[model samples]
Target: MKKYKGYLIDLDGTMYKGTERIEEAGHFVDYLVRNEIPYLFVTNNSSQTPKQVAKKLNEFQIQASEDRVFTTSQATANYIAQKKDQATVYMIGEEGLREAIQTSGHHLVDENPDFVVVGIDRDISYEKYAKACIAVRNGAAFISTNADIAIPTERGLLPGNGALTSVIAVSTNTAPVFIGKPEKIIVEQALEVLGVAKEDTLMVGDNYDTDIMAGMNCGIDTLLVHTGVTTKELLKQYNSQPTYTIDSLSDYLKHIN
Candidate 1:
């Protein structure tokens, strides 16, 4: 067995589904603590803040601090901060997205913004879409967090960021510049925060399209847990495969030592 010094983990599927946490998810944190390995929960969900994510992890019996959670919201903030010099942004997302952009020293506006940033905003209305479209049409750079089509919920699967992004995509006749998983930006940010090289970091997630593919793209080892969106049957269909596959995180941890 190879020893890993750092981990970039997904939250919704890999650690918990809705309000329920997977058995080995907490145990894996314990193992990391005992062995002194650095770990962070990296999520593509830009709806919630880091504090909200940390609280959710606590409910699942995993002790997580605010700093341990890295969301696409943060990544978007970093992207804007690095590129722009105080620009106004039109936001079509949640409070997390608003906070992230504002905290990065950028202004959030309703009209004539320098950029249009979209995320998962459940209360999104037609007017919001109209505004976003108008802004982008007027030359605002369109930036979106992730393209996840569906989000798993306690009720069932709900519309995700991709669905909203699709509307904007059609309106502007331009694709959004993505900064989440499957793109190198999020994974690269995770590696920088974890301070580990790609070879020594392991990415554990349940989504084949985003999580696993993102890890594979970044040159890190990926483990696919079948408990999420991707199933064993789907693996055969994907051209990109994970380095390892497990029925669940519980089964994967059994071989950790």
Candidate 2:
């Protein structure tokens, strides 16, 4: 097996399933830590900050730190910053998204903004949607954190940020530039943060559509573990495949050893 110098790992389904811990995942992370393998937990979740994410991973007994977590919120903020310095943004999301934008030296406003960025906002209301629509129609560039239509939870699949973003897109008849997985934007930013070349980095996740595609889009190898969204049978139906496939992280651990 070819060894990878660095890894970009997915969070939700790849690390833990909602509130439950994935035991094998902890072991895999432990192996990475023991070997001092460079890795970053790349997540599409825009609601929680890196500190909160690290806290959640520690609860699962997985070794993680704020510096090792990369979120879509951060990617969105970085994207906006690169496009225009200190651009004014009209955002619809939670604390993480808000903090990312403000910390990146961008201004957040309610009216006549330079950009309208959308993420998962559980507290979404008609007024928020109305304002977003107005801003987009009035010439603000539309951007969404991810295109994930549904999120898995203990209650089952619920509407994700993509679904929420659709409200503004449909209302204003405008298409949004999605920054999260299945798109190259987030992965490209993550590579820069990880400081690893694409040829030497591996993207690992349980979702084929988002995680695997993100790697492929950015010319990185991918590893798909059948512990979450995609099943063995389901993955077989896809024309493209991950560079590596394992039943669990434990299986991959054996190969590294």
Candidate 3:
């Protein structure tokens, strides 16, 4: 068995879906604890704060703390802090985005200033889209946390951040500077938070486009678990590859011993 000293793990599709926890996701954390491996729950979902994520994980019986998770919302906030004017942002998403910007020491306003940060908002409406479009047209820089077009739920796949991003793209004739997975910044931050070097780290996820690609982009070995968005059949169809593939997190432990 290949042993890793640390991990950068995806949360939504890799660990759980919506409010549903994956089988053995709690056990996987126990495995890490027993092995004394450092791991960070890294997520591109900028819709929730670290505390909120921790609460959700805890509700699922997973031992997660705010310090153990890193999110794109925090990254976006940090990115905006270094901008030219510390731009006042018109946010079109969840409270998590607004809270992150405020926590980063940047001002967030509804009416016109500098930029518009968009993330996954469950309450997405046409008015929200129109406001974001207007803000972007008026020269506010458009920033998207991630480009995930759809999110898998027990009911079905639902529109994700990318859908809203596309609207802004067409309306403003501008593309957003995405800060989430498939991009290097979020992964880098995750590594820094876990204090792990790339060689000693493994990334476990279920998506090829975001999770797997993010790990590969940062030179970390990727594990694709077939418990969420992607499946073995889909991998074969797309010719997508992962360093390791397991039917599920439960089956993954069979090789651990």
TM-score leader: 2
- Position 122, candidate 2: lDDT: 94
**Cand. 3 TM to true fold:** 0.87
Error of 1 at 117 (Å): 0.3
Q: Ranking under lDDT, best-scoring first? A: 2, 1, 3
- Model 1 off-target regions past 4 Å? none
lDDT score at residue 27, model 3, on the 0-100 scale: 90
Pairs with steric clashes in candidate 1? none
- For each candidate in turn, the TM-score is 0.93, 0.97, 0.87
Global lDDT scores for all candidate models: 0.87, 0.94, 0.83
lDDT of 1 by residue, 154-196 (tens): 7888998988899989977999989899887889888888898
Using TM-score as the yardstick, the better of models 2 and 3 is: 2
For model 2, the local distance difference test gives: 0.94
Q: Lowest lDDT 10-mer window, candidate 2?
A: 11-20
